[model samples]
Target: MRSSGDTRSNSLRNIGLIVRREYKNRVTQRSYIITTILFVLFSLVASCVPTVIQFFAARSNSQSHITIVNNAGTTADLSGDRLLQYFNSNLNGSTSNGAQIPGQQASQSKGTPHFALRVDTSTPISQLQKDVKDGKLDVLLVLDRTANKDVRFTYYTASASLSDTDLTQIQTTAGQLSVLDKSSRLGLSPTQTQNLLAPPVFNVVYTQKGSGNDSLISLAGGYFLGVIGTVLIFMAVYLYGMWVAGGVADEKGNRIMEILVNAATPFQLLWGKIIGIGAAGLTQMVCLVGAGIIGLLLQGPLSAVLQTGGTLFNLSYIHTSTTLLLLLLVYFILGFLLYSTLFAALGALVKRQDEVQNAVGPLTALCMVGYMASFIGGSVAPGATWFKIMSFVPFWTPTMMMMRVATNTVSSWEIALSIGILLVSIVICAWISARIYRIGILMYGQKPGLRQIVRLLRQ
Candidate 1:
């Protein structure tokens, strides 16, 4: 009365039960919980660390004191004096009590010397060295105009850790002074020379219409999303790939897989493990995403205090189309399943723990190749026929298609075509992996290649 179909169905149900048990065992384990918590904490800290640093940087900038020893010649109507004055004036709108001249009246209640420009004309060299050594000077600028055609500046800072922006501004000012001096000497008017010396005016050009909303911010946003997604995909692979491989190896090593095979076929057990580990990966990803959202929300005020002109935290880049997100979710799940199943089968072929890497070498290489190609495809040859063709291929499709979608370069038809090809490839890969699993899971003391696998599949 018992049919083969009914028996197969019952066997599948048994495999499902096994899968559920494995999923629950892993998900509820203390190690998994601790790892998930630590991962979330690390991601939160990493995300907010930049903002925290920027806040401290801004506060330090406001509170910072700069002692400027201008060793340039005096009554050479030293342009250094005018440059220092301009710097002090510019600092006014930036902080509470800004930069002040050496002899200027103190305006603030604290009387903290924000900055002081000391024009030292006494031998300039030894005086500068003494000032630097005495901690009386933070920076020493020697403006020389002796027999030289142009003004030359030699700067010295006592501390090795001087701010780059501050140094750049100092250099820019000196360069400006040098250019202006040269132009004045050559009889070119200040206004004409200033006009000529000013930076060129340029506008960004784009060939795509209706993509006017595309800005550096959005492009940067897309790149950020692409990087995060790719990294997450790789992380997921690392986490669950090892899980699949290790689980298979553990069962095989312990001779537990042999006993399980008496009750259910290897295909059933293989898929069960894949599903179980996939569930565990999803559970961890949920925790990570939740922590990220919480961190983004809570860290906003702290972020805005540090950055200029725009929001410190933004999730608008996550506002991708529903269809694309759905497709991505599907592809991610399928891709994980495809790779993890193969990882399990390959792992079953190995006897020792150390042999796992060697057994899975081809798969790892494939992943690396796909990842690298996907990265380069959109960046280097977005319009290339080969790149477009490869985007529809399942191996590289997840990263390539996702990037193209982010860059708004992928069309609806292309997405449809890629999805179709990916689904078909997934089916074929799953079948191949299932065949290998059936032969490999119970196999012991022997490693197999494509030839052995092909012979096993035929059998």
Candidate 2:
């Protein structure tokens, strides 16, 4: 008989061979390559969506054609000449009254008129309405004077939603004109009227300490990290766990497990498959993350070209401390191993590939529950007592702890304690799953009941 040391070495060699075989077989598949490339491209495109929108918005001609119908006649305080001039000035990126609006910066394309204004005294109101309906005119303004010496303005448009900026400009112009007319009657100087209309400056200061005094950019970055990390972990666990289950079921259904068991123990097969698949998944994730980083790096230059200022993909806000990164990596690996091992054991109990889904349904439900809880807790109450307690539970720790870390609410001691609990749970799960996997892989034909599995595990 071979020495125990030689046997252990041979077992390790066999496990390595299996891992290499599994990894190579999956990675070389056309589906894997195509899917990876497509997913990476999709991530890159998604990050640049804001820049694309800004590019189109900048290039498009945004001018609105407006026609004015002045029914106030010559006796009214509202002059058609002044109204037309005001509209033109405001639409052409200037304030009414022949003055540049303070603090108003021109758009990338300088002097692009936002509205084209024309006074149409000869066109009938009916014709103007038809023009608006036919898209020949964007807006029609009808000006009249009330008996109380107040000017009345009415607007008609074919569009369902009128531009707020356009409406605000018209309102401000009318109000200024009315004020000027009254100020002239009261013999007030232009300077006094200007002072009366100018907006007042308001300043604010924060004095509270540790009151979540983070900037909006930093908070947004933290939220993005939490959400993206949660989604990535969830997808990796669920998708790769199902793959492990389906792969095991496929091999068993074809009676290939009998041959494989002779070459290596069931425990070796289980871990080899999990590690190999996990590595493959990690490879895909690394590619996706790399693509995202590249996209973020390109965003500044792209924003300059597209004139979008800046977008949420700004990397300056994301905190990349070594401690946080290490914690994320550890949590993800432990979480993957925990779920994938359970799936492998369940896969062994199934007699056919079709039964894999039924065998893993409970496990999938458990994962979904943890995922939903983490999302709700993180978004609704990150610092709630219940959320803190759930973060210590093995099943929920991966998601919940990652969320807390992303939000900067988790302490180092708390992380250590949660990880300790998770490690213990993983060890226990590995032992139980190995027992079940060794016996279940040999059974076939009829699906084994819970009692039968328990009895087999005892043996």
Best by lDDT: 2
Each model's lDDT: 0.69, 0.78
Q: Write the per-residue lDDT of candidate 1 for residues 2-42, one digit (tens) a residue.
A: 99999888988988987997899888889998999998998
* Candidate 2 collision pairs: none
Query: Model 2: how far is 80 from its true place, Å?
Result: 8.7
How many clashing residue pairs, candidate 1? Answer: 0
Estimate, for each residue in 355-431, the C-alpha lDDT of model 2 and write its tens digit.
88888998888888878988898788878889989889898889889988777677778888999998999888888
Q: Where does candidate 1 have its weakest 10-residue lDDT segment?
A: 93-102
lDDT of 1 at 263: 81
Evaluate candidate 2 by giving its C-alpha RMSD to the native, one decimal: 4.9
TM-score of model 2 relative to the true fold? Answer: 0.79
For candidate 2, the 10 contiguous residues with the lowest summed lDDT are 100-109
Candidate with the greatest TM-score versus the true structure: 2
RMSD of each: 5.9, 4.9
